[model samples]
Target: MEFFGMNKRKIIAIADPYSTGHHLSYNKLLVEAARRNDFKVVYISDRIGCKYINEIFPDTDIFINEIGISNSKISREVKKIVFYIRAFQYCRRRDIACLHIAYIDRSIFSIALANSAIKIDKLLITLHWNYFSSPENNSLINRLETKIFSWLSRGSVNTNVHSGLIVDDLYIHNIKSKYTPYPIAVLPSITSHEENKLSCDGEIDALVTLIRKADVSLLCFGGMRYDKGADLAVHLLESLPEYTHLFIVGKPEYFSKEYLNNLAMSLGVESRMHVYDQYIADDDIQSIFNACSIVCLPYRESFSGQSGPLTIAASLGKPILASNNRFIAFEINNQSIGEVFDSLSFHEVNRAFIKALEKSYSPKEFIEKHDPERFIESIGEMYKVNND
Candidate 1:
């Protein structure tokens, strides 16, 4: 591809469907790395994602496209098939050297079906979850997808996973894979005045104020889903001291605000629980984390994968109270960052919660291990090696 008067042959195309949550920061990191390595990027995402990228890096030679996929499950699947077909066509037309799929779960079937029809120099997939880690995922459909994905991995496609445990699992299956530390966005430290100024019209400020009122607050950030053990977080509040509060942030996916509040009220811990059932912007993240004493990740046993919040908490030097997921438990124990609990057992969670509050943590080692520059360099090297 030619930009201005210069021809840049190393072109990487990154495609992610959703723009919210970690995608915004993760995509921005990839774009930054691509720019630093002199590789032109074609970022494909939903309309909001395209706008977000254009606004952040206005001067960079990056091409952004809107992948028109609706929110409905069936509609999204059909649209994804069409989108991948068109995306590959665009890649070929532009002579894009590499196509990296940021999330591979939803598009596995589409890509497998389109594998023979489309051609690209290099294809990379980031596996966010280790589907093969659990026997519960032995459903027929999952098995079929696993077979297809394994076939794809055995070919020209290279898989990128955040967990070393996942890499070992893939190795046993004879799939080519590499481990890259999950990129954590470096959020600027905001003082009380700056935080109040950056709040979403006083909403976040009010939440922060309420959380700070507690002597020690536990924050459960991100989507409130069943697998994430949102209910367990509320339950744990019953066992802790009254002054030890719990803050639930992020949009509620499986449980509503009223449901959680009613649950808390029924358990007699309503006074100590704060729930912000809305999406929190990136600028406001550090302020919320700062307001709380610890970050809680009560994910269930089925979720044997890495967590964005875990890394976020580590970066800010906040102690964590997380479930014993394979990757999360390993990170906490290996880095000496925080405590792990049995998510299914209330007694264990409460015990671990108290211990985590009392324990002094030093996240200097964790921060150094997951430095953003190291992640960026690894990703850049992956693309450079593939291109060569």
Candidate 2:
């Protein structure tokens, strides 16, 4: 059913304190999706995210800390602590129909603390992953965090997760979750298929400069964490054809540029790679996507959340070369968008890379079953379930 006469109902989206530039894109999409469904969104985020969102979504209601501090772990946490106190106050003064927390782990303590002070009709938490199978994920700190978040979730109307596997995992732990697919972050402006083609001579020099030089531009976007397989992408370059160039984009989280370069040099493929070890600007995101023949996501099993890069790639109609993680595998097979390799086997990775390079195509359709509209509708259903 269409959402109508619900414009006054408040849906607040509290962003993750540690959200990076890449994540803000999807966060904006979330706000837009909610507004499109006739609900007014009260977007609460860090100063950086607020600025970015203001530029993209000026009409939405927004609130951020006044200090406007720099992006750092301590600063973000401090800002969020302040934001949460203010948020609870705002909710207390007004009847908020629902509260949606992004990066829910970061705000669990705040929510738990506020629960005794105030109550709301519906509470929704986005659990990126609950990797109960991984021993590393069961450390004392992680365990404590999980218990707190799980306990808070027990009171929530619905816990949102990216894949059914995650829902099943949460089920084993007795916390029910809803499978909400990650939304398409970037919507192509051009509807005609012919207009979407990337011209080799486009004026986007930063991207074109590299795309024009290589036969295949293999893009690895987002944080350069070891779990993200940046090194694996570099390792593939050691034996890849000289025509293929690996572009590892995003800020270095764990892997340093000097280390990556040295490894590439030792493998004798340093000349065929470009490592932009900084946060990519928003406009440059599409440039990088346009310049590449295909997107690569060799993420390790350690990563259990949805792949934002995969969503972005699908949005731009670019093919993906992903690992065999259940979510990635399901998306690749479900949409016929790309090929999946055995993440553990370099041999399979190489084969998938070759296949991706040999053919470039887009998915037949978006994962409509889990698209944003349906996601909002699901949340609406949950709201009704709780309010009834």
Candidate 3:
């Protein structure tokens, strides 16, 4: 816990257990940067996150255990309470100068830690998605949780918000938090395991086959949700030329095959539509990006955060056609990295589609400005400013 008699500038990234490969990639970039900056980097995460960190960074110090948390409604509350207690005790055991957590949502652990009696020099919590900004997230339970969280967040100096829009929303609700956009991490290379293609046997084969057969592909990646514009994507794909195919990947939640098939059948474009309702492999990320002519992100207006898919698309230099959501619109204006559609109008969407085909933008400048090292350094500067 201490180097010699003095406590080192120890930083621990409290990586969330239930997160995407994107988070793992971000963590690897972060800690590596921290290590280069002469800080002892520690990672505290659940079993899955720990295994991934080990595989990625073999010699990193990681504290891993079962958080016993589930998304299931039956025992979510009980599990979260238990996890919070354990997380508190775990942090108390370590001599952490700064505790950095990313992608905070409904979790109360960050707020609790920041306000706890533990003598942490600083606790930084990065919020990925902002629930209060999403119009559709107005259920009684969600509202109640937001109200409670926002109330507690006002008194905490640890929270880092990713969107200017979310920051404004939080301010209106009296929850003061810092606005810090997510940094663009480096794209992962094709690993030996990935290059082997041993796991390409079943579903992936079918996916690759479908993608290969298409003359032009429009990728609607990420999980299917109402906010993600799955229905709109299906409809747009239906309206496209016969040679164009829509590759709808990722597990379906609010969107379903039955609904999409029925829509496709009705639109008489079922033959041109190929849907793989499963999670895509991390190694095949470049393949997916390459296979598609355009990456579509027609998310609803309610989305108010830095989009990982958008960042990845930019990182890979893929052309993007995204709806004019708050953050996406801001990025489009700031970087000219993508074309935006008027999400309110179908006619405008069709025009945007045509525009994307003829348009291109370089992500080179954007990518350079937010590279991992540059980004982590900015965070270090901010931490210094806050501590000072």
The candidate scoring highest on TM-score is 1
Q: 193-312 in candidate 1: lDDT tens per residue?
A: 244354455888899888888899999999887878888889888777777889999998998899999999999999888889998877878788878998998787667567878877
lDDT of each: 0.76, 0.66, 0.67
Better of 1 and 3 by TM-score: 1
Q: Is candidate 1 or candidate 2 better by TM-score?
A: 1
The C-alpha local distance difference test score for the whole of candidate 3 amounts to: 0.67
- How much is 284 displaced in model 2, in angstroms? 3.1
lDDT of 2 at 37: 57
- The predictions' CA RMSDs to the true structure, in order, are 3.0, 4.8, 3.8
Give one digit per residue, the lDDT tens place, for model 3 in 130-247: 7653555677766766766665455334666655666666666566555565454544452111333445657676677678778877888888878788777777765466788888
Considering lDDT, where higher is better, how would the candidates rank from best to worst?
1, 3, 2
Better structure of 1 and 3 per lDDT: 1
**Residue pairs of candidate 1 with colliding backbone atoms:** none
Separate clash counts for every candidate: 0, 0, 0
Per-residue lDDT for 1-388 in model 2, tens only? 1224543254454444545655675566567656565566666666777787777767666667453554887776666666666666665455566767666645566666665466666666676765542334676756666666666766544676666666666656565444454333333322222333444334345655776568888888888887788988888776566788988888898898888899899889998888878776555566677678879898877777677778767766788988787767877787777888875465776788788767756544664543555555555554444444
